[model samples]
Target: MTVSDQENLLHTSSYYAASANDKSMRSELIGEQSCDVCIVGAGFTGISTALHLAEQGLSVIVVEGSRIGFGASGRNGGQLVNSYSRDIDFIKHHYGDVVGEQMAAMAFEGQRIIRERVATYQIDCDLKEGAIFAACNNKQFNELKEKKALWEAHGHDQLTLLSASSIQEHIGTGRYAGGLLDHWGGHVHPLNLVLGEAKAFESLGGVIYEASEVTKVTEGEVCQVTTAKGVVSAKQVVVAGNAYLTGILPDVEKKAMPCGTQVIATEPLTPEQQQAILPSDHCVEDCNYLLDYYRLSGDGRLIYGGGTTYGAREPDRVESLIVPKMLKTFPALQGVKIDYAWTGNFLLTLRRLPQVGRIGKNLYYAQGYSGHGVTSTHLMGKVLADALQGDTERFDVFAGLPQYPFPGGRMLRVPYTAVGAAYYAFRDKLGI
Candidate 1:
């Protein structure tokens, strides 16, 4: 499908949307509204930030263009991998040791935030523990060994490197040279998790309006955000739309490019089949730039996802794009029927690190998580909330990092990223 086709969707026809728990539709913004904070988007970043701010006694109003979790937050591969998309070594090499150390110390905070919310809110998103990074080549295997040591130096001790033979104990496939097991990394039912967080935010007196697409923003001490049918005047404004941000904020649009990703869900496997695939019940993602990530759902379906179209165009059919890759990893399931398939977009920055800063004095924004929104968004929600309350220490850690607009700016970033990705993918294929 074309980018225009995907852009017009309220939500993908994916397994998560089909199985979503909140069947009730939220009210839309129909008239003038006012609040302490007016957030534009009800995905994880918006919902989590609202929950945190409301807990701090701020009146919060969240406005989503579509439904809550209707973007990448709900549609992503549910793996809860910690740290930035660019790892610590990359951070240190590019940004230097001071910023890298700060990033490392806070790398695992997002996972902790997720676990705490799941338990505290009693969210039943099929939360599970443990995730594996499968290495397809010896070079990737050696990098995993080095990564473990680097993580250990940063005080992460729950990582274990498995040899090729030992990898079979965790994963039932022989496609991996070895794997890195992260006890803290895991998976969850992403849509349900975000929906539950929205409910939690509501319980804290936070307000949310679905289908209230923000069309314009007038920045001032009290920012005014206008939707199609209503206007929101607030003490502060937050633009958390990520890939779905569209052109609502021009400054933000320049810093990141949206890219499409595809996923497929197989028919529920038998208990025996489940054991034969992921025996340890751990989510798995490979070590390539263009990587495959898969995990078993609560009902035993293989929730497999991968493939990226740099220009954010949907695949003609999700199954056609991802099923062959799934079959390659587990050829035993060659004939297994795919139950559902869908495509979603994620914001990719040139640096691959999430961008968090202000559009103006009273307006705060966070996006460009690359594919690491699962963890980074939650961590950022807290930081954004804290910064709103006059504590910018943690927030500065991110805002201080240089923000480089895509080399050719918004119009050309997509093709530029596509070319860069093709190069890395080729290197991965060549096992260099």
Candidate 2:
């Protein structure tokens, strides 16, 4: 999904697009410019970085190909779940306690940063707290138990486990055996959140150029970033395009594959219907390998999403794919009209973790957040800003992650990964 109004990019008719607070496109770059740091992409990662850097009294410039929050940042499920996509348990088991603990220390920093920015800058994105992790089977419920314990060991103790008898309080349906509640987890109007942050950055004297796609980036004592109509020179450059950063940085882009996820928003529900479906108004995500996440929007619409399409191809009809899933979760809403349906892409890495590192000494990038871009992207911005200011301690935690291309190369990667995911999906269906 992109900002189709401006540039030639096609915008998905998503609920977020319809509800976004800002629709005006910014001026495009048409002349040479210089800054302390030039960043590519104006989504969460880029705007977050610019906001952090500007707060530190740095002259930062953000250049976007389409419009701010045009990519996944605008099209996400809007859940503010903490931690990385793979979770700290996975990182600790594979990397070791020294680095694992270090990663854990920053697990919840993203949500904290978002909350601080919202209150400090007075951003209005319909923010809310509380999230539920529903378990479809006993196997997944057991995993949730371990996840809660692991997170507690890492300094977070906001989770409370639920039994089958008590699951209905947060989730109305009987589809879950048990679940876990993250008191700190929450949701937001993602597009509005990014737009607010972009405005906040501008208030701090940060410059942003829309419809200015970066064509080339040269690493040197003074980095040079070239767009269609202008060039920006800076001491450092940050590539925050995520899945959209294709040809500009082939090596980094190759390390992740773009995958599309779909979501549907139903017509506003009656107050009683909303109360029946989500008693506590908490966002709920099931523990299926291919999971389903649903929540009640500020206007009482049932926003439901699930299913994945590798290679970032939009489905012929998102409602067709998600409607059945929503019905299975809440059969009482069978007759509800679906008002909006759309699909958006997220970068998935081989290791299911973020890929971050720098080329030479001045060019840096962070992407491949899997399905956890909402929170991880914000944390990456802070980590990136710190690194640019001569603190590489947190930066090294991500940069030290091993990078590998898809096992079967670009031609066969999609099919091979699909086959592997199909196996796990089969087990999920069998309640294994």
Candidate 3:
């Protein structure tokens, strides 16, 4: 959000922005406001948390630096990706069986929460069902098989593993070795989804102030959050800014680095092109360290996204960077006209797991979802609201997870992570 200009504060020049349902902005916070809970951010986490708390009859106010869903929540691949970035197998191997089972049980709950919200609120975000994780090689394909079995054991049986040949049924690409489809997974127009949630929050008596950036937070029995033009006092504060939360909370900022991922949407594809590119119209994410994710938009455009620029640095000519990846997946789309290209940032922790905890007895925070946040943020909202209501069982489990600062600190985190990613990407290329 620290862009050179101020207009960019409202929303980036993204396909989502161009198609946002709500172009109107909320007024900035003025003078003084008070609430039972004050959340800093208007993205998925903030809006989701606010909606959850409001559903339970709590007074909540969200102060955002920009418009609702202006961050990664509005700019991601828009896939309803279930589970955390680390997944259940990694949790089971490293954190033991009980913890793993606990995580697995809640893995698909985010999707359920999302579906419930859409139905309850009658949100029109172009909700569609089905998603696939394609593997580039047999090794990666085997890993997907293992994950399928592991997920099934944890009671997630909406999975179907595809052989190399069967993979073509879902995607037109021959580059993938195999894939795993999730019947419950889907995609959405992300910005509209968050905007709809914000509206839903408003309907529940929640308050939100757009373009009101918090400059300082003084924690006490009653926390005081100071913004550019106003102040908010609250009994509890929840920090949900994620990558954009830098400078406000040094501890949380150091534990995660801002990562920029770019996306490009080709001009609306014809019916024939759509069938060849994304048969069945299911969203697809590859099983690579730096994976590529793409799907057919509601209007039939091919929205493809991949590549990373760490430290929140937006690269020049995003189209040039992403078009190659898109071509590799669907070569027939070589000469397709690109209609949109934009970059969005998400917080990435060293361990690639979300960081959830409290600064004090009254301040709670959750961020660093890595790249899998669409559903996870909704899940965190439920857990955080429950935790605030004295149900800390799930929240405690997540908070207990280890959170470490970057190795080289802020000065070298970008290069350090880039090198590490290069290594893993190299391994992905060699199929090992």
In candidate 3, how many clashes are counted? 0
Candidate 3 ranges with C-alpha deviation above 4 Å: 1-5
Kindly report which residue pairs in candidate 3 clash with one another: none
Better of 2 and 3 by lDDT: 3
Pairs of colliding residues, candidate 1: none
Error of 3 at 264 (Å): 0.3
| lDDT computed for candidate 2 | 0.91
Among the numbered candidates, top lDDT falls to 3
Residue-level lDDT tens digits of model 1 in 103-134:
99889899999999999999989999999999
What lDDT is reached at residue 34 by model 3?
A: 95
Error of 1 at 315 (Å): 1.1
What is the Cα-based lDDT of residue 172 in candidate 1? 85
C-alpha positional error of residue 83 in candidate 1 after TM-score superposition, expressed in Å: 0.7
Go through the candidates in order and give each one's C-alpha lDDT.
0.90, 0.91, 0.91
Residues 1-432 of candidate 3 have per-residue lDDT tens digits of: 455537746588888999988999899899999999999999999999999999999999999987898889999999999899998988888889888888888999999999999999999898999999999998999999998998888888899999989989889879988999999899999999999999999998999998888899888999999987899999999989998885788877898999999999989999999999788999999999999999999999999999999899999999989999998888899788998999999999988889999888899999999998999999999999999888999998899889999998999999999999999989988999
**lDDT accuracy of residue 109 in candidate 1:** 94
